[model samples]
Target: MNRETLVLPVLAGLLTSALAGCGGSDDSGPGGGTIVVGTTDRIEATADAPAPLDPAQAYDTASWAVMHNAFQTLMRLPRAGSQPVPDAAESCGFQDNHSEQYRCTLRRGLTFADGRELTSRDVKFSLDRVRRIAHRGGPATLLSSIDKVETPNEREVVIHLSAPDATFPSKLTTPAAAILDSHDYDPKALRKGFEVAGSGPYTVRTEVDGDRLTKAVFTRNDAYRGELEPRSDTVEMRFFDDSAALERALADGEVDVANREFSAEQIDKLEAGRVAGVRVTESPGQAIRYLAFNTKAPAVREKAVRQAIARLVDRQALVRDVYKRTGDPLYSLVPTGIAAHTNSFHNTYGEPSVAGARDVLRDAGVRTPVKLTLTYTTDHYGPATAKEFTALRDQLNASGLFTARTQGVRWTRFRQDAADGEYAVYGMGWFLDFPDPDNYIAPFIGKDNFLNSPYRNRAIEDDLLPRTRQKAQRALAAPEFRRIQDLVAEDVPVLPLWQQKQYVVAREDITGTEYALDSSAMLQLWELGRGAEG
Candidate 1:
């Protein structure tokens, strides 16, 4: 079938008439009753802390919370599943049997919020700009497979890959692949300021900005052409400095929904009915927290030193005391419930043993009481971080094999410094962009990986990954993933600490808590709603 004939009918089913009456109740009209959502993550645009509104540069979860709603990609994750279906594109698939060339046909009459045309050229431009700018610690790494993009026409886009990659389409579903108007964005650099031109479910009407954003106002984008119909006409996003402030907002009924950075104590209080009218929903999260080791650092360049330190960590104690058992002890880079997840750390290290740690250190001819510096962000990862890192330090010191000193920096500076390898050891977290084993493995082990800590495993990166990508069925590729995990455990570049349980607290009147969290563990603001009480 020809591209136009195949896609036009699908487009008709995907989009509602632009002239059709807004689907929700009249009271929920654009900018009417706002759905206030609270989070501990900050939003800023400065030389030190850049705002995450720009799709080309923003990669962290804080920015993705807003970007996912404001920007539309060719494909989008459904409200429930990990697999992505077409959002802007009417149809998308590999053109050849080898999966070397992937193509998508755009839906007809797509336009940005400004009414500018959004065509295949814009899609090519957006992906190309990501590669060109290639911001350090940015999402550009996600597009490493694509060699070039070819826009055959206004509606058809062809992506030629450097090698066969089945995960390329999944990569397009990420915020990094957000289609942008060529007319609105500069082709060479990241756009400055908070202003955005997107074709997503909502558009930014106004923003209350500072080093930390007080409020961000988003109204329904009438130009949006996608399957996700907004339940609430307007969304008001509020930023808090800590979980205490967020809990206070929830109790005072100032916010309808609260997500990200909530502490274990707060979750306990909410579940115990400490908050009279609020409800808490919890789900298994793909997010994994870990400790990254900078191999180049003299203090830990020795494999024995790294493995000895790994042996000193007690995952159960950390999860129970620090996270209050709200999360699970993780032993591999890939979290549990995903394909080929193995407890490689537990298998290798066995348990936290002061004797074993000392033996490893002593056998390696390393001096006792090795001085090591551990770093983490005080503001970004929530209040539990201080307690968690302190526990880690205590474990190491108690082992008598090491003397550890802990340092904390604010997130903005911490991110930049971490990428620059300023700390020998530091804490980091990963929230998946897509729910695949490859999403968990490739980004951390790739040539230019997410960890900014220089780690190269040729067996996993060049050989295993390419081989795994060739398998059409992800389940069939389990053995390779298992091998990758085993290598990661042995290398000890990063030690998987724990896997989190996703939680979102909202008022009793609010509905759709179940649908609010997408497969990526990101809350969909559009899915939340307030009943008559709202």
Candidate 2:
């Protein structure tokens, strides 16, 4: 279908809502204090860091948390909303009727932390470098649709796409699309250093007290020309080894605000007012946990086997028994709050049934006691993962139709082995890059997806996604997204497990916990501050 006939009307209608959603209000707080944010996430030097802070090279959530404050993208998401608004760019929209050409105009008087003029050329260079370097497991895959970049002048940048993608603007809101100073970074390779240069709300300075990174200090950027205004003059982010250490720091007054890594027990205690001086804030999280099946594996390659295994999964049991009802039972890749969410898995598999599962295996001429190996990470996901896997094994073994063996691997090695197709079935979790339903679907099922599994559906990759992208209003694409969810349920490549609930704990003196979480579930450093007494 031609882009003009299919995509232009929707694009036109979307711009108004996009503009309205992009507006952000300044946060209200007592202000004038150094906010110390504590997290269990490790921030290491190049020698021990999981990934560098370079915008083109960093893809993990930990790195993005710091990079989001240090660097600026052409479009930025507001602290309270998901819609992309102009950041470094004064304004942006489709320049052609086809919706394949997008243009952005640089804001006047924008400069990087290094005092270099920020222009369209830097925007073009930043995008081109991500695709050129294409680091493994990096977010360059987010920009795979861009055919080329055109600079009409110093102020305007035009991005030409090979296909129409309504979600392209949302991609630019990610840290991967962060614009860099052309004069500071070499275009040929990834930037080599702990420091970064960009036009954002804050400029970061890294401190290493020992072998590990001790702290990251973020000072308000005077040159920033964006919608967000820093409530605190400076933010000091400290990294801890685990949730216990992080919680202790908050109780001991070592840290003012704590970001994530709280166990369910700790959360319950804090919620019940057991903690002396801390309060917990809860929000609907965009993260999901699932089980991925390697289609190339001999035992799981059979469609009937996968379907039978799907029937054996009890999401309610997993949530109640394992998660302690801390999260909601998820039945599709698209979480509940998002548009086009359906209970496809429940519709397809019904409740957990031993007889039905056994019949499915018998119909396929498979023997009883089917052997399946389940792999998961012990250190990364949480302490609950081990118990979760154990529960899964007990559930499957109780049916007498399958014998499940569990294996534990560290996160880094597990990710590599999963990509290599070394395991038959594995546990995985997804944190959203953007709040759109497309973010939930495209990244897991699209070509060369993050899963690295061999499963592929031509209808999902080629037809449904492209057609959905043609719609200007995201809600209008509900039918297509629902249909895609049904297809995923039928295929059984990845089974939706559960969706997380976000919990942020802060001291009584700390304000702005209500606005701390952005649309992507990342903490907004600019929203936090201290009370008058603090």
Candidate 3:
């Protein structure tokens, strides 16, 4: 349950082999089989769905899972492994002046499902559309590095960086950089729900109401040339409301694989060999859960209150009780496996003790019996979140320095309230949109941060990030990232709680399941087939 298990030693070194087996088999159909996958809700393929498919608009990990199926970028860092590979543009290597500008030439004849010719214009259109829509909740941060995108011709796209960006091409490998067909996209039309319009292996064929979604089988587009080749003609995704339902479906043989939304208890049951014929694979997840204080609130605006709470709760107990050994206690926002993720907080704070909590409050000239309302989401993360918050409430109360009242709400509503600055303090979880130091910093440290946390660290925003983004070499990314971690520890705006490992369980017929730095790592649909026993 410690933090050392998560950070990638060298970011690029790991990316080299990340998605090795994610590419699907070349065989046409599943012969006579169907791979049923389980999720928490039904997917409606409209622009307005809870998880939309528009690459420019998606920010949530769940949405990106669907979006990636429809769109592709010049290059992609596969979900299972650590390396960057060409997905759409054939091959991508930086052109001259490796500093502020890079140009990539497209492979000929790649086309959208609707037969729109894929070219440099398409890439430009995707980037431009993201900039134009500029959804406050979308992938605007990913596009923050680009100063401008120029398509001089149909085949060539040149991206001018705002600073020296060594990771620009790698950024493009994510779904955030997925190219869309501008010809069919309507900027004026703000359609919500799921809709597909790109060149991935599968197309959104239909959605049956009541939480079950069926995707019309994938057929190789004559122009499609990515590494993945679909084996099943069609894939059906059944969505449930919770882990219990999803697990039940898996046991009942209603689904062939579990994509996401399983509780730690469910994973344990599967791991204990309780579910026969099911093969389980585990990976260190690049996800972190933390307590984010809303600095905009008057009481939490005090560092004493924030630090006191951080000292009151025990991270190891929290992981063991709530996460069921599926999580590692976090000492830094950048989890252990990522490059430059140092245990700066643990180095500073040590461990949770009542004396430490009292000292922080006393030093800030705050008297005992500090009362605050702590909020948590019931639906988000898992069923254990409420119990986790209750534990936090008890721990703080037991410290005798603070009295905490707890509140719980569904995830969607909780997010709306958190964004509106309604809570004094709340439990939060962050699964990276892309695995980078910027992803760790930019969202939580800026003036307009994601958590409604107005915790602005000028060092991260003005100095560390700008300096780090300019270098192309991965080795150079470490020092700057470490500096940001130190600053994050000092500010204490968000208390790093724990980093969770993601687990996937499937019938033994499946193989090649693994974790990706970006939380969307289980590429079971690819390289999964019936085993010899089957």
Candidate 4:
């Protein structure tokens, strides 16, 4: 219920996870059995864009989970914490006291799935493609700190940043920074098709139906040369439309692990030991969900309209009744327990007041009964979405200043719709790209947000962010961070909703479930295998 239990201590965690090697296992032994994992998260594709497995185009959790396992990065999160460690790189760190420049030296004899050598050129090419293609709704925004990449030799990569960014190393661990084969990928566009190659612990064989990635079979890469040693032979990952199907698959022995998108009721049952033969593992949940407005859309483009909606929302009721108290009500983009967090929204609009919304609308000369459309994904977050939207609609209608309607679509279409700016207001969730407050505030308000929103604040993009990045101590950036949150509250580009915990359920015979997840919310599939008890 509190923020302390949800986020780890910042400086202390970095030190502990850096020096402590006890949280991980050294299971390099061969495994003959296959493991099946199920989740409601799906990799979306369209006829216009057939790029599913390309790391440059992947910005979602489902895609990140798949690509991170199949592709190695220069830096990776430790098993127990959010700080970065060398993965494909033999040794990596910043050179300056201000954290401006970063360097990495690749491990020798690294090869791709097809036995192609991986070198510093591949790392430079992978990062360059992210900026070159720059697909709408892609993870390219994470690379805003980098000025350019340099390869001094075949084994060394040097990066120069536009500004000092201490969090720059953590950004390299995302799917966006996935070290790719320079020969296999397109430099100008997203590589077409479901097939992809990598040099990580596993090599993936994908199955696509229409536009959805139905299943991906990951076989341990015998040619891989990285920091991790594979514990299992193969992993079969399946995607479902909803949590109900995921639950049934887990119970019917169709899946050896159920990873994400469980309904509140099912989670409660699992916690109470109602579901037999399953062991649950929990992580300090840093993921936050909120509503993002396409600032180019009509009606929603008005600042007063957005601020009014913020005043009318009752986060308490939404969390208690709709979510079954599974999440805490979030009032800021930077969730509670994260550094520089403040309840700016809650402070500005104390308790949902109809009068408060009406006064704001009237003062702005906005006509009464302003029409609004609220969009949500049917299959993305969980089953409680419709109820949440309905609750929101009712809350807005009761204010008598707006007429709100709701629409639901599958994530495959909904994601495209939001990026195209086809919706006035839409609901979206952000699992962390890294464990920094900058990750929360920066990604949502930029000019070319992955959502394709046109909201841009020069003060936030240029002034506040650079000031915060200059300091080594993250807590020292609180003054600029507080100003950034204040500006967000005033602009009202995104309205914060709630922060929820993460859960992974596996069979009792599964080994290494406790060390299966890193602080970045990525699943370490290499840590999983059948236990001797099985």
Q: What is the TM-score of each candidate against the true structure?
A: 0.93, 0.91, 0.88, 0.91
- What TM-score does prediction 4 earn? 0.91
lDDT (C-alpha) at residue 250 in model 3: 70
Evaluate model 1: give its lDDT. 0.76
Q: What is the lDDT of residue 200 in candidate 1?
A: 90
Global fold similarity of model 2 (TM-score): 0.91
- Runs of candidate 3 exceeding 4 Å displacement: 1-32, 41-51, 78-81, 96-98, 208-223, 514-524, 532-534
Error of 2 at 36 (Å): 1.4
Model 3 residue 174 distance off true place after TM-score fit, in angstroms: 2.0
Go through the candidates in order and give each one's C-alpha lDDT.
0.76, 0.74, 0.65, 0.77
lDDT of 4 by residue, 1-534 (tens): 000000110111100111101111333345436777787766666764468667766676667777888999999999876678998999998999989899999999988989999999999999999988876666777887789999999999999998899888888887788988999887988887677689989999988887778988888899988768766877778888778887888777777778667777887888788777776655446677788898778878789999999999999999898888778898898888688899989888888988999898889989989998899888667788899999999999988888999999976677777778898898887777777788787676667655567899999988998888888778899999989998999998899988776667777666766566677656778877776623
**Per-residue CA lDDT of candidate 3, range 1-534, in tens?**
000000110121111112211112334455335555566632333323243555555555555555555677887766544456677876666666556777787877788887778889888878877777765455656667789889888888888877776767666766668888878876534335455678876665545453334432333344565677655554555557777877777777766666455667777888898877666667676667788788768767888878777777798998888777777899888888777789878877888878987888888998779888989877656677788888888888988887789999865566667767898888877766455666677677675456656678777888888788777666588998988888777778888888767666666554333332333241324444443313
- Give the residue spans of candidate 2 off by over 4 A: 1-30, 43-50, 208-214, 532-534
Q: To one decimal, what is the Cα RMSD in angstroms of model 2 from the true structure?
A: 6.9
CA lDDT, candidate 4, residue 61 = 69
**How far out, in Å, is residue 130 in model 2?**
0.7
lDDT of 2 at 33: 62
Top-TM-score candidate index: 1
